[model samples]
Target: MDRSRTALIWRYAGRGLLLTPLLFLLVFFFYPLGSILQFSLAPDGKLDFAAFQQIFSRPYYRETLWFTTWQAALSTLLTLGLAFPAAHVFAKYQFPGKSLLLALATIPFVLPTVVVATAFIALLGEDSALNGLLMKVFKLEEPPLHLERSLKIILLAHIFYNYAVALRIISSFWSNQSQRIQEAAQMLGASRWMVFYRITLPLLLPAVTAAAALVFMFCFTSFGVVRILGGLKYATLEVEIHYQSLSLFDLPTAGALSVIQLMTTLVMMIVYTNLQRQMTQPLNLQSSRQVARKPRRWAEKGWLALNLIVMSLLIFAPILALIERSFTLGDGGFTTRYYEQLQENPHRSIRAVAPVAAIQNSLEYAFFVTIFSVLLGTLAAYLLSQKTRFSRWLDPVFMLPLAASAVTLGFGFIITLDEPPLNLRSSYWIVPIAHTLVAMPLVVRSVLPSLRAIKPSIGEAAAVLGASRWQRWRRIELPLITRSIAVGATFAFTVSMGEFGASSFVARPNQPTIPIVIFRFLGQPGLANYGQALAMSVILMAVCAAGFVLIERLNRAVIGEF
Candidate 1:
């Protein structure tokens, strides 16, 4: 009877742990989101659907809405088609440096969109090396590769950003699938194409759907890439919102856009969750390592080489091009002039910031974001790893920030946090707090997998061996959780560093981070400004690469689908 009471008491105590993160999220995330809903829908102390009505009735808003949907849909399709074969190779084959290659492919996922835009420009822009080569080869006066500021370029960028998501998610699911079914089909005289068409592809549908929904959501709310690369000809919902609120100071229009984007994202998030859940439904949980082997046939070797070359070109060419452009001068001579200017802050009057100051600010913000997000995520991980009554439903709510537009969150913070006791309009801490909303989900994802892997028998064994509950935790749980925490902290730092969405809204003009600095430079004219943007982009990529290297080096034992 006493033991039962003690267990009951501890269950309630464990449940009480959720309150901390819940309260924090309520204040920072939910309250701000609610504030945006209120501010837009009821601007004059009265509810009205006029803003939404205006959006549908106006040609500009209607076009943006249509473009956002179509672009996202097209991007999703392109990404899936491009990524499917790569995912297949990763699942079925073994290769040297496979893990490193996979990690390299995933680096783009963590990069700021501005950085990616700059990289693409460096690779394919008019004066780019590839264009130089093409011009020389074709003996043409015009640059042959004219991808800049085009819908084609936008789709390619989306493919680059989302390639790993499809590869990882689909491969992870595919690797666990038993090979016997496919082998049976082969033995029954089915052609290779027939086997894959009827058997392999069908089994991968759930994961494919999940990846598509997620990729679509990302492309839908895309702001930085479109703003930087889309020029004046294109506008998505996110771009429209940015222009409305920041450029035009049209709050009602921005608010309506935010609401529309939020609703769309919510629907996709639900779809992704349901589809992903279906991916883990009990099946033959077999390992791929035993089934996977290296290529031997000529056709197999050709296919493997093709995938490798294509993936490498897609992933590394932009980065290499950016690095080269940063050093290349007017006469095509190598110079460090652009990098040298990073310290000068020469274009501050035109919104350009000192690169060093921006780096320091981003690092400082990332530091606090890591601390706050890890703490909140640790609590949430505990709730998820245990048998908490509400954890199942609460799990997806924690992921809302991942799906929500950063611009919307930033705008929400602007209106909500600028008044009353939460007057954080000028507070330096606000950016990191805003960043924490996104970073928290990363930490939760990183930590929860390891937490869930803990066997109950380990604790029972410690108790039976005369260790106190606290002692068992100190000697057992803490060490196990520490690895995940370290990785989670790295994730938090990376998220905060590359975060442009929330930072776009919260970061002050003069006190901008690296992405903001790069953005400001890119938006302006002149060769010097463009060169500086490339230089800063290289720097940002280096920082992100280092962070990803750190993450990969850390305990990859902590595994979960993000």
Candidate 2:
């Protein structure tokens, strides 16, 4: 009876580990989700399908849904098409600056969507110098390239964002395939085509599927790029949700769309999650270094040189344009006028805010999110280490925020947390709270892998040696997981700095995020305003790149998944 009672106490204690994350989910995630879902279904006291009826009845909703899916599908295809070649280049070739190139490819994915849009405009917009030069060269009256405010730009931006994810996933899978099989097949007179189709492709399918699913999910929920680039002509469900809730004040429609977006995202995420599990299954293959060789043949040399030029131009040209435009005056001479104007209240009529304040706000919010995310994520990771059925089920739940659209969460803040006991609309804490929802998932995923790696027998051995639980954690577990936690912190910091969709709904009027401020600057007319937008974008890009590099180095000491 005593032993059973003791076991019960320990069980409850172990279950207590989940309380923090569970409460966070219940209050912040579930409550807000329930509020939106309830608004859609009930609206009043009694249950009704009026929102659904309105949705199905309206051509607007149908069109938005169609465009969202259509664009997302196209984005996924383009990203994959771009990624396979890049991944192949990295996997098969040993070259100088390969790691540097790979890292640069990843930079776009980590950047705030607004920054990317700004860069694209600076490089490809009708008024851009590049376009102007091209027009002069071609003797065209109008700017020949009309890439801005169109689906083409949107597709390109989506590819930029997802390129790294596809490359890493596919390359990792690619590297693990044994070269012996290919060699053996070649010895048997099998063609490279036959070997690839009959062997290599079959092996690569799992990782490809996982990467594609995630890319689709990201493209499907895309907001910043679409909103900034697509403008009034295109509307994804995310943009539509923002429009209905904030613009039109149609809560019912917004609520319904949020639910739909959430459901679709959840399904894709679940699929990716399952496929990822399959990707990690043991593969009997050689390291990439063994298979990789320097460019020898003319074709190989040409391929390498072509990839170098294409990737460099793709990643660096836009950024260079942004920098150039930020400096160039209306008369075309370089000046610090745009950068200098950041200190003053440039536009009084339009919600005037100092550029410095916006930077401070972004940094402070990022710091807050990093601290909170690391703490909550550490606790969640601890719970995941328990290895119970509940823990297994709970693993995916932590990732729900990653799957959920930022706009949906931002809208949830307005509809639920704005009133009564949960009233946080006026509080700046709400911004960090929203950021935490997004960041926490990354934190948990980063740290959980490391936590699960630590054998419980080490803790048991420590316990038998008279080490307390806290001491064991401090000595053994903390040391092992610190790098992962650091990785999560870096991700949290970057996400907070760059987050736009959720911050859009929750950020106070005068108090705006960096992305929000850059967006505002982009909206105003004038070369200086445009230049300032570019300058601010340059600043943000620098910050994210620096933080990513530093934190990435920290994670290299520990074997943890991003």
- Top candidate when judged by lDDT against the true structure: 2
User: Could you give candidate 2's per-residue lDDT for residues 241-266 as a string of tens digits?
Assistant: 99999989999889999999999999
Candidate 1 lDDT by residue in tens digits, 484-503: 88888988988888888778
Superposed model 1: Cα runs more than 4 Å off: 1-18, 347-349, 460-470
The TM-score that candidate 1 achieves is 0.93
Residue 398 miss distance in model 2 (angstroms): 0.4
lDDT of each: 0.86, 0.87
User: On a 0 to 100 scale, what is the lDDT of residue 412 in model 1?
Assistant: 85
Q: How many clashes does each candidate structure show, in the order listed?
A: 0, 0
Model 2 — which ten-residue stretch has the worst lDDT?
Answer: 341-350
The candidate 1 region of ten consecutive residues with least summed lDDT is: 345-354
